[model samples]
Target chain A: MRIAVDLLGGDDAPAVVVDGALRAVRADPDLNLLLVGPSEAADAVIAALDPVDRARITVRPVRDAVRMSDHPSAAREASTVRDAVAAVRDGTADAMVSAGSTGATVTAAALGLGRWPTIRNPALVATLPAVGGPVVLLDVGGSLEPRAGILARHAVLGAAYAAVAHAIDAPRVGLLSVGTEAGKGDRARRTADPVLAAEPLPCNARYVGLVEGYDVSSGARADVVVTDGFTGNVLLKAVEGAYAMAGGPPAGGGVPRAAALLGVSGTVVVCHGAAVAADVASGIALAAHLWRHRATDQMAALLAGHAWKGHDHIIDTEVTTP
Target chain B: MRIAVDLLGGDDAPAVVVDGALRAVRADPDLNLLLVGPSEAADAVIAALDPVDRARITVRPVRDAVRMSDHPSAAREASTVRDAVAAVRDGTADAMVSAGSTGATVTAAALGLGRWPTIRNPALVATLPAVGGPVVLLDVGGSLEPRAGILARHAVLGAAYAAVAHAIDAPRVGLLSVGTEAGKGDRARRTADPVLAAEPLPCNARYVGLVEGYDVSSGARADVVVTDGFTGNVLLKAVEGAYAMAGGPPAGGGVPRAAALLGVSGTVVVCHGAAVAADVASGIALAAHLWRHRATDQMAALLAGHAWKGHDHIIDTEVTTP
Candidate 1:
């Protein structure tokens, strides 16, 4: 299977991306890679690789990348991310990965691959290392304010992804809130509690009502925790900050530097803007794992059974219209 | 000044509360206490005090206390928290402190003391330990929304509180968001970003665009960080959780176990539900400090200057009606 890597992505791009590519290619003999960026950057990786394994590498040359100087919207015209997405659609690659501007990549993927039937918002899922196990947190930076219907949709998506991607069956789903009370949290949360309660879940997943912030670190309350992207992003970084404050992360792992973008038609992984070589390698590995599992297709099928009828109206009135 | 203390106010109530009162009374020579709760619990404090200090203690018998089980609405009823608030309102006590339910304290305070003019939602503010200095975070559990107007008002309240209570001059105020970019963050943040920027801040506080979770811990950015109650509450708990996970806390201090409830007509500090002896003592100290500094009155006066003309109306119309 072939995967496209957006070489001109991340804070320390090309160099880290090249280093990660060499590591990913060396680790998986069956993995075929398409480096989608500048030839000079691709040459850096090829020069370092074993000559005999060079046949597995493909280069799709693209100029100009999303730079720190460029506007986030400039990513639309950057060409690298869009080319990466195109490779997936054209079947030249099974999946793609970019550690670039999240908004840019998201916009590119949505425009190129087209969203699923009911998913108006694609969710970015990160696996946080916790005491009990890895806590799968969704919408890390996708939709900012999720409506009741969208939250219910995310719950279904997160559950199926946990089962198909993480091999966790019957994943417990939870709504993140200030308290675990029946009626706690902001207006949207209070409104969505009843919706999440009644919605049907995939993979035998059950909604565990409200869960607190500590639960994200403990992994005791739920396997799949759902929240709007805004809160989820800050919470993710806060946990990372906590680990930093603690000298280092716990034994299991640290806050994931890479997150899998679920709900898209193909497998995609995103790294932190400040990603290092190790972070890039992890993102590549995560993308490969998702591709091997055929997790996206499986998750999609599971979600198809749980259709949300009231979602469109909710989005139009509650979210989009404003 | 006589301060009524609820001996049965926290998870380690009575024992810790009694121990805490002893510490406060001994530490602050000018302090006089009116221990209100079960007489046996109040007796614990009297028993620990020396003969000279014993004369300073008074007991008010309360058969029932507000349990963690008691709903927030119960605070408006005839409970210890209500009684504590009433003592101050009726001129029997100068101020009050509780380590009981926050919702209950908020309810009791709003009902008994009445809100500051035009202040519909009173906020909970906590001072976190930061490397650069103390970072004053607000709305730890006040209102949870992105109303541009309320956030702007919180900016003023936070600034005034910093100047009066924390003694920070020309405090730098920041709006919490996912990114530091001008247009970064979800809808509320995006809208409120400009609002806060345009707000005529009090006490020479300046708006410092957007800040992330790191600023809250490091205090390298704005002195006063403002966000919706939902994010602030969860973020505060998460920080406390982080401090615990990191093995105790930083040398400077731990996450403040007690928070000062702002936007009310009087000085009030609410401790954690699981507050220990030292935590209660600190809460009492915070209340005394604020009272001594005339912080509450000054903050009220500050709000009076920048008061959102119809904040309560907005709360009633935008939140409760839905």
Candidate 2:
């Protein structure tokens, strides 16, 4: 499979991204990368590769890269991340990976690839390896405002993604809140709990009312934990910090630095902006895995089959302005 | 110092509470406790203690206990937590500890002990042992909705709390957000950032822009991390879960099960509803330490001296309706 790599995306862009691209090509023989960035950065990756593997590496020269200080809408400009998305849009690459600002990557992908009809806001889903199994958390920097409709829609996306990507059958979906009981959270949680419960879930997923923060790391309560982007983003980082404090992560694994962006038409993976070389490499691998499994198309079909017919009005009324 | 203990508060209440009270009296010879609950539950504590130590324990019989299912307003009734607050109010106990519904405990404490005039919302502060020092996090289940004024006030409470409770000098206070960069979080965080920066802090505290979830556990950025209660609550629990999954906590300590409530007139410590016997014992210890240090009185004086004179209009206009 071919993946477009945004070499000028991370905090240590070009250097780390070049190192990551070299590693990805070496690790997977069948994997090919279309490096999108300045000519020098792409050359850094190609120069390091062995002559035999150079055939698997391609370059799309784009000088301008999105900086962290730039606004998300800056993706509208001709930047590396936008070009990476364009590569996937034009069928030059099967998927794309970026370690730029999450907002910029989301904007570029949503604008370039177009979003799924039913999904108003795209979600960034991160999977944590827990005791029982992997726990899928969604909207981890996508939609910040905690509206009931957004949460419900994300819940659907999460369940389908868990089933398609992770091969979890009949995933147990839970709404992340302060407490596990109904009406246990703030106004948004209280409003979202019932809406999520009433909404029909795809892939035989069942709504498990409300779950607390502990459930996110334990993975004993639910497989798919849905929350607003703000809480999910902070919680994910806090867990990463805790693992570091405890010496290291559990045998299962550490918190993921890369998250799959759902709701966009093409497969996309976003690495943490401060991600290391290994993190970027893993992000490229994630993008390849998703493309190989046809996860995005499968999730789209599943969602289409179980559309929010009963909750269309709520979704329509609560379309948040970015 | 005498502390009022709510015997019928937690999930395994009366039993764990009785055990916890016994441990507290045994550990601190000078400590005295006023047990508020059924006579049998109080007697259970006295029966387990030595004859000499038994004198340190007194009972105020109140059968009605607010269950988790009950509304937080139910604290207005003569429940065990309410009675415990009354004991503190009437000077029978210098402080109070409860392993009950946080909302109910906040309600009982706020109503019986009264609130500080400048602070409109009461904040629950938890201290985590970090690499540098103890990191103080506030509003862990107090105010859920994220109003900029409430967050700004919480930053003040957290800063003073670190200096007074944890003995951190010139505590570096930070507003918790998705990223350390300015304007990187949700609308609430974006609005609160500048307000907190402009607000004058007590105890030589200084605002350190925005810090991420990693700062909360690492304590590398700020001694005090401030956020709305919803985010704080989940972040704390998620950290706890991560530690558990990683085998155990670091040598410094684990996530605190007890949090000190600020903005109330009397010293109050609220434990996790699912607290164990050890957690309850530690909570009682925390309350005793606070009372001995006169933390509540000191914080109130500090807040009063450095009142929100510059931001009074914002505080007055954004008074949340509980």
Candidate 3:
């Protein structure tokens, strides 16, 4: 399958992205890339591949790109990210990957692919390799100020994504908080705990009550961990930093620099802005895996079976509550 | 110096507390402990020490304790934690250490010792051993719902703490957020960024703008990282978990099971409720170090020189704002 790659995303754009693109294409003979950026950057990738493998690369040739300093709304402009999303919309590519500003990618994807019904806020789900299994963490940078209902909705998304993406049956979903006990977090967590427990989870998943930060890396408490964008983003980075300080990650793997953009209709992956070439390559590989699994569509179908009534009203009320 | 030990605190109360107290007393020749809990638990510690070392331990019998499930305010009763606070307040001990519910310890300490002027919320500061130096993180579990003013206040606290506790001169203080770029986080961070930048820091410290979670372990961005108690607590635990997953902490040390309680008048140390005997001993050692350095009083004296005028008004307005 073909995946659209944003050539001018990330801190060291073009060079690292091109290098990553080459690595991913060479690693998987069947993987084709729709390079959406300046022709020069795309040609850089094309020149590196052999004549027989060159046909796997196609150029969309968008000139402008959203910079790291640009606002999330800048994706509305004619940029590489926008064009990459457009390629996916037109079926030129099965999925898209960008190592750019997370906000911009999320904005472009939500606007271009359309968010799933009953999901006002999209989630960026990252999987951490734990001893027991993979621990899925969500909202790494999607909705920053999620109310109780939004969190409950994310619980449903995380469970479905875990089941579809990782093939973990009956995933135990836990709300990330300061403590594992009830009423151990700020106002947001205190309100969301009961809401999550009451909400019906898809894929036979069950809410495992409140969990502490230790559970994120240990995976001893839950298979899926749900948190607001702000905490999840910071926690993910902190864990990565800790692994770095400790010399290296466990034998399993380190924190994935790429995260799936859930709640959108199309398959999209957002890599960390500070990602290196290997991280970008992994982002492309993750996109291909998700596309082949049809994980996004499968998750949407699973969510459709679970009715989420009255959540919107509850979220509205909670948001307006001082 | 004498440190009051909360013998009935922690998940595995009495047993671990007694074991920790014995370890602490044996490690420091000049260290003395005032045991506050059931007589049996105190007797166990006294029984373990040699006759010559027995004088280093003093027993204050109090059978009741604030259970993990009890409300933080339960420390108001005649529990071990509350009695430990009384020991500090009455000059029966120079400092106190508790491997107990953080809420109970914070509440008890604040009520017993009185809060420092201009400091409404107490802060629990933890230091992580990074590659370059120690990175001091504040408000680990002291103030959960901190407004912008509280965060700005914490910046000042963290700066002085790094200088006094760790002897890091001119510490670079950074606000923890999702991204390093200006205006990259939620409304709370966006509001607090400028406020922290504007606030004058003690110990020749300066604000380093926003920093990501990686800075917490790498010490690459700032020596002092400030955030609300909720975020700080979770990040600390997550980093600890990461270190555990990576085999062990870096050669320096792992996440400290104990954190220093700031913004209160007396010296207090709060250990993780899941703390083992070694963690309790380290908490005692931390308390002894602070007592020797008079860190609590030094921080208060330093803060007194900095004008915090108009902060309360801004905090009130922001809290009331939608």
Candidate 4:
């Protein structure tokens, strides 16, 4: 399987991205790369590779790619990121990776790969390696509102993602709130609590009502934690910050730099804009892993199976707007 | 100054309450207590204390109080918390402490003491020890919206409270959001960010623009961080959880249990629902500190000074809803 890399993304541009690409290529012998960027960036990777290994690499040289400061729409269609998506859209590559602006990567993917049925907002799924395996959190930086309907959609997405990607049999879904009590949260939460209860979840997932901030780290209440992007982003960082305050993360666990962008059709990964070389390398590995497992396709199929009957509006509009 | 404490508050009621009360009395030699609950509870406290120290303690027998399982409105006209408020209302006590329920304490204080003119929702202000000094966070569990006008008013309330309570000279206020960048937040935050920027802060405070959750722990950006109650409550707990995960807090810092209820006409302190003996004692100490320093009165007087200008509606509505 071939994976495309956006060389012009992230704070540390082509140099770190180039270094990360070299690392990822060496780590996974089965990995074939489509270095999508300017000539110098693609040449940098080629020069560092042995002749035998260089044969496994392909270059799709574009003059430019989506810069972190560029508008998502202004990213040239022929740039590495957009062209990388086109490669997947044309089935030339199995998956793609980017460390660009989250908004831009998301925009390119949602526009190029298309979205699942009834999925208006695309979710940024981050898997935390908790004590109970991987706990999948949705809308990590997507959909930043607490409308019951939005949360309910995320519930289905999280459940399907868990079943397909992590191979969890039955996921327990929990809505993040201040307390576990029925009426424990603010007005939006009070309104969403019952709505989340009534909504149907995929993969035989159970709704555990309300859970607190601790659950994110411990993963005690639910395998699937659903929240709006606003809360999720703040919460994810806060947890990372807490880990920092605690000196570091719990043993065998730490904040993830790479997040899988689900809902858009192809296998795609978005690394943090502040990511380092190791982070970008891990992101590439994650994309390759997802592609190997056919995680995106399987998850998409799972969601299709549990797709809501009449709420096709979500699917038709925007899938990964977060 | 004398303080009245609800004897039947919190999940671990009566016992924890009794233990906490005993600890508080022992810690503060100048403290006088009015234990408002059952006569048996009051007698139990009286029994625990030495006869000599018991001279400083008093009891007011009242059976009614809001239970965690009960509706908050139960603390309306008749209850132990109401009586405690009444004690302060009638000059029987200088201040009060409760760990029973936030809604109940807020309601009791608002009705018993009456809201300060122009303040609709009274804010719960928690002071976190940051690297810089003390950072005051308001609306920990009060309001949960992103109204620009409310946030503006909260800036004023936070500024005065920081000065009067924390003794900070020129408090810097900030709007809590996902990112520090100008437009790095949700819709509500986007609207409130500029509003907070344009509003005039009291006590010589200034707006430092948008800040992240790190600012809350580090206290590097602003002295007063304001947000809706929902975000604050979750953020506070997340910080507490982080401290726990980290082994302990920063050398001399930990999560705060005592929060001062501002925007009301009387002096009130609310402890965490899971208050331990030290939490209760610290809460009582906070009450004493506020009263001894006349912090509440000074805050009120400052409001009175700015009553006609800034925001007359907020003056009567909420101390700050930002």
Which one wins on lDDT?
2
Better candidate by TM-score, 2 or 4: 2
Task: Tell me the spans in candidate 2 whose CA falls farther than 4 Å from its real position.
Answer: A309-322, B309-322
Runs with alpha carbons beyond 4 Å of true place in candidate 1: A22-32, A50-56, A67-78, A307-322, B26-30, B69-71, B90-92, B305-322
- Tell me the tens digit of each residue's lDDT in model 1 across B109-165: 888888887677788889987877899998787777767777877787899888988
Residue range A94-170, candidate 2, lDDT tens digits: 99999998889999999999988777678899999887899999889888888888889888999999999999999
Q: What is the clash tally of candidate 1?
A: 0
Residue pairs in collision within model 2: none
For model 3, the stretches where C-alpha displacement exceeds 4 angstroms are: A313-322, B313-322
Residue-level lDDT tens digits of model 3 in A1-322: 9999999999999899999999999999989999999999999999989999999999999999999888888999999999999999999999999998887888888889997777766788999998779999987888777478878887999999889999999999999988887778888888899889989998899999999899999999999999988889999999999999999888899999999988888999999988899999999999999999999889889877877743664346221100
Residue A278 alpha-carbon offset, candidate 3, angstroms: 0.7
User: Model 1's chain B TM-score?
Assistant: 0.95
TM-score of every candidate? 0.92, 0.97, 0.96, 0.92
The TM-score obtained by model 1 is 0.92
- The order by descending TM-score is 2, 3, 4, 1
- Candidate 3 clash pair list: none
Question: How accurate locally is residue A276 in candidate 3, as Cα lDDT from 0 to 100?
Answer: 90
Full-model lDDT, candidate 1: 0.81
Supply the global lDDT for candidate 4: 0.81
Once model 1 is optimally superposed onto the true structure by TM-score, how far is the C-alpha of residue B79 displaced, in angstroms? Answer: 1.7
